[model samples]
Target: MDRKILIYPRGNGEGKGNSMSMFLCLDETTLPPDTKLFVKFLLRVISQTPTKSDDFEFKVENHFGPSCLNWGAQKFMSIVKLNDPKKGYLVGDTCIAEANVTLIGEVTTAS
Candidate 1:
């Protein structure tokens, strides 16, 4: 399956979930350490098929737009694993879609 690395929230508060609601997210830095719950991590495309060693992760990024209070971008943690859309691309229906990421993660643990 075609896949990418996805960054998301660790919990439900501060804006996080299927809603894609505006939320404050952290920049490349400022992410907390020693996080046992969830943290952001970027990795290369791992596969085109499912594998046994596929490990995925997401971090809480500050919210965006007016609803999220335009926190600009901060950081949080992730609590879910999103799958590819059966009929749409990742983070679709946006002006700057190519630059926007709906979700991301390794695919099949390709080596």
Candidate 2:
């Protein structure tokens, strides 16, 4: 499966200015026309601190297709919490984001 991770540091849509937005996006161009995918995915922001890692994570299952290529949380994590040093999400001005996706099934129209 061809997939990509999308993150908005300043957030997106509803999350803008309040939290970070993260999403799993299916590459529609790589898929056959009228194809749909059922997928389970996990998205995380890894803490960079050496002492402890308080990761922020979200998981969900959804369908993706040409019309719906993306699915994820609008409020993945609060901006204040992510930027706080105590949270350990950002260290030395760097933060790590991860995505794990599993393809549960696929369907395609017989055209």
Candidate 3:
């Protein structure tokens, strides 16, 4: 299955504060049947310009549990704290963020 990764800004509905996060997910239709596996991945994000960065390392197992029709998305790096000025999360009066994702491996059931 093909996986897509991306980054975006999130804010409370009340307009309290905004934060950055990453989403790693795959298409459920392509999941191998009657099998369970562990997905190891890394998500990295950096300023589109030149500035700070962030990353997450973890594994997603039981992604195809019965409760979910689709494998669904795995969200990470929420509530990221961004410092203004030096960090330059926003520069040139523009906000730019880039995301990169690497799928390390998928350990499937032996039987």
Best by lDDT: 2
In terms of lDDT, model 1 sits at 0.27
- TM-score to true structure, per model: 0.17, 0.92, 0.48
Clash totals for all candidate models: 30, 0, 0
Give the per-residue lDDT digits (tens) of candidate 3, residues 28-101: 66666554334544444444444344322333443432233333223333444334545555455565433333
Q: By summed lDDT, which 10 consecutive residues of candidate 3 come out lowest?
A: 65-74
Error of 1 at 54 (Å): 29
- Per TM-score, the best of the predicted structures is 2
What lDDT score goes with residue 31 in model 3?
Answer: 65
Model 3 Cα displacement at 109 (Å)?
Answer: 6.7
lDDT of 1 by residue, 1-111 (tens): 122223332323454453222232334322223211122223221222334143322234332221222232222222222234321222232111111333333222223
**Considering lDDT, where higher is better, how would the candidates rank from best to worst?**
2, 3, 1
* Local distance difference test scores for all models: 0.27, 0.88, 0.44
Instruction: At residue 74, give the lDDT of candidate 2.
Output: 82
- For model 2 the local lDDT of residue 7 reads 88
